[model samples]
Target: MKTRSMYKAERTSLNRLPDPVLETILCLLPTKEAVRTSILSREWRYKWTHIPKLRFELRDTTSELTSDIETAMNAMDMYDVYRVLLLHRGPIHELTLYFDHYWEHYEAFECDQIILHLLRNHTLNKLTLFGLYETEDIWYKLPASVFALHHLTDLHLCTFDIDHPSIFNGFGSLQKLVLSYVKISTKTLLHLLSNCPSLNTLDLHIDDYEHVDNCTINELLKCLPLIEHLTISGDVSQWLVLDSVPQELPTLIHLKYLCLNQYCISGDYGSAFLLALIKCSPNLEHAHLEMEYLLEFSVVKDKYSDVWLAHLNTLDLCFCSSSLEIEFVKFMLARSPKLKKVSILTVVDRKQDAKMVKTLLRAPRASRGVKICTWK
Candidate 1:
């Protein structure tokens, strides 16, 4: 009688679990674990497919499955994964696929065929694809079907070659885009950006910049009118300049954060670029600049330097080789009356310079809220 009562309590607890709660628990498990649950009962068989977030990863890890099952799983292909995906009738809100590096052994055409199949059926709101391609051949362009998925809000592509610009027409709803090691022309990039009017955040990790021609800083800024957060880490030395104050980018007036790292600021172009930023982002609240070149104030000697110091509330300067660090500090104290916080980090080993930085921060300013921290 006690055993019967215990069984009844267990059944009650299982029945009390809401479908959403059960789904959440299942979603957190690995794909293999989720699939194995199908053996439990008829209700569990189709439960894995109901998960809103689908992640399919293919790797050569030996520990992924038991020794006996690994061989059988290896015999199966992407088609099996596609079948599993098709079983899910619900909308796929987030989809991530990490293709195995061994994809080079298969025909490129086969890979494209499989990817096209996935893109056709999935209405992905967020998608991330990362894999090593077999070749740099032009035939490696992303499946054209991707452009038809207008529902995608966030897209991340890493180590992929986007050879065509027309593939961007369907990304009008995209709000965040991250690209790494992508090879595309500046014209293509402009065309892509023109479609994403709602884009608010952009992160770029460009290893190659030779394809960027016939596009200037002003033209790029004009395309992304609503971008509020911009994080750029690459070789912008070639393109960092503005010959004229941009009439465009007024919409970027809402831009509040900017981060630039490992950027080389040299030549007349650097000055123009800095001036354009100061003029365009008048409401910028936070900025980080890591300049890796010798400091020469030829272009921004007095006029532009004052503009930066006046507007910035939080500023972090890293790896600057300027001899006039004190001059910059004095300029900030005088121009940025409302500036309340500052962090100066010297990338090189320079413990002796902290004393001078401390002295500069203690100076009286219009904003008594000002605080400074220096680290080497």
Candidate 2:
């Protein structure tokens, strides 16, 4: 007869599971919770160290912390992040560090140290870094060590600044790059894009700041030769046409989707820029345009009469019911032969809204299967 305690321990032991199975369970839990499992038993002490992905976020804790408590909490949180990184085994494939707006005391040196630790293993392919939203003065300038991760394929950065180094080599394997509210000069932006030859998707919504004199649209367009999906928002749309509406741009043969949010269509430059981009993206399938300001004049149809959206299936237009917008809508209705769905979001009274709906319903259509939906 065997001892009862020994039999129970043997029957319920997690040590019986294979290391791969244990790591799989740890991966399913939150990174914080996964680390806490170290206290469960001796066998689990180092199991979480082998877990590949780590996500550490400083959530808003202002509501719950007093002055002294907040300081201690911040210190503890910072220590936990470093402790996990120092003790972790194997290569970390993905890492996310998000500092909430309430975390105002975070230092740039701390961010640099974290990046340095990540540099120990080149297995990191996907990385996301979000800086504090309120602290514009404190920017985490990307160091040269960041570009050393040649295996990086996806990168998302927010509220950071980029200073192009003289000896820099680009992320050769990068495919998707997203920069939101980032502050980078035109020279640096072009340098970053030119080197990312494998880049196919880009979402750029730069912060509103005075740009350099050399920010020309023609050169910028040339860098994104293989871009498949692009989202441009805020003042960046205006910057692209600061010099003049480009007469010719390299045809974006791979571009299938384009979303322009907070886009300026008010002046000749704005309208011409919009038309020029559409003309170059002949294979565009989905176009989403959210106008920022009311247009001063209707888009001259003759400028883009030869352009036909042969593969377009979806068109989403968010604009007031202005004559300029109506004219653009009419032109799209005539040109898109394969269009399947059109969604319009606008602000209008009941009477004018009905009239606008009737106008679009009566507009000549190249696609018989197209369904038009509208909302206020």
Candidate 3:
């Protein structure tokens, strides 16, 4: 009896599929795996060239085992990665590259060359570079070509050195930008925000306090006029002086969501900040806070409570150390007659506390449309 030829029949059927379908499947794969698919058949050889997404990783190949670790680490040079990117000539919709200092000296030069090559191609819509650190005198600056890529909608840079403000001079079509662990001045950030007029979301995480002096909250807020969502997380302890309170935030009136994490909203300045929110952001519907102390009755009376607690619809309170929870809740209920939903969140796990919240929710409320939730 003769055995059926399974491999030959499957290969023939695969060859019959149209290039678009094959390209779609190839696009779903990582850059390395997509390149490997060329070995499947002659038709599949250049399929990777049509893929829009490009992702390159060096850490994925390194072995953690003691015996093979050294060899694997040696093979994980940045130059090899750069050469691979140089060979790929296609319209990349997304590109992700990660670099490390463990690589040899020659790899740093190669990385620069790869970046220069990327500058020539203007099809990149989303670009992400992580773990990029300066090595020796090998300074890394954002290339001028990147600012001209009008198709770029999202850009994420982590731990990279950007020395020039001109690098972000002409990004008119960018929608989202995220920066972390980068040294950037307020002037540079303002330039970037002014260029990206279509920006909707921004996230900034600064690990060092030294760079805090370069950017003020007011200057940063002025950059994005049409921003709908904003998240600011950093050490604001140094910048929380009462005198630095903003006079107006006319542009931030359209903001629907706001998150302020690890921030100290204490003393009279905290009350002033809340008052500013009331005066500036009339359309703010959702608010989340992890404040140190809930505002006291005397502070609220002195500052005028009616301005700050009038128009809130959704409120989340978390990790508060103040003993004025009941008083605050009562005050909000009285002030926000239109309040729909309220969530009191606690950092510590307390089953009984959650049950007590449930009991409160079940009780009859004086306000007809109000719903309260306590999540522990």
**Where is model 1 poorest over a 10-residue stretch in terms of lDDT?**
133-142
Tens digits of per-residue lDDT for model 2, 148-178: 6777889998887777668778889999999
What is candidate 3's lDDT per residue for 327-356, written digit by digit as tens?
Answer: 445555566655788777765457755654
TM-score per candidate, chains pooled: 0.78, 0.84, 0.75
For each candidate, C-alpha RMSD in Å?
5.0, 4.6, 5.2
Give all candidates' CA lDDT scores: 0.64, 0.77, 0.61
Q: Which candidate gets the maximum lDDT versus the true structure? A: 2
Summarize candidate 1's per-residue lDDT along 1-376 as a digit string, tens digits: 5797886676667656899998888778655567777876555677788887766665544325445765445333566566766677665678766666435445346556655655676566887776654434322345455566687898887766665434356477899988766666667677888888889888875545665554567777887888888877666654333445453334467687887774634444554455456556777878876655554445354555435434578877664535554555665566666688877776555654665665675665833778776677
Q: Which candidate number has the best TM-score?
A: 2
Q: What is the lDDT of residue 201 in candidate 3?
A: 80
Question: Clashing residue pairs, candidate 1?
Answer: none
What does candidate 3 score on TM? 0.75
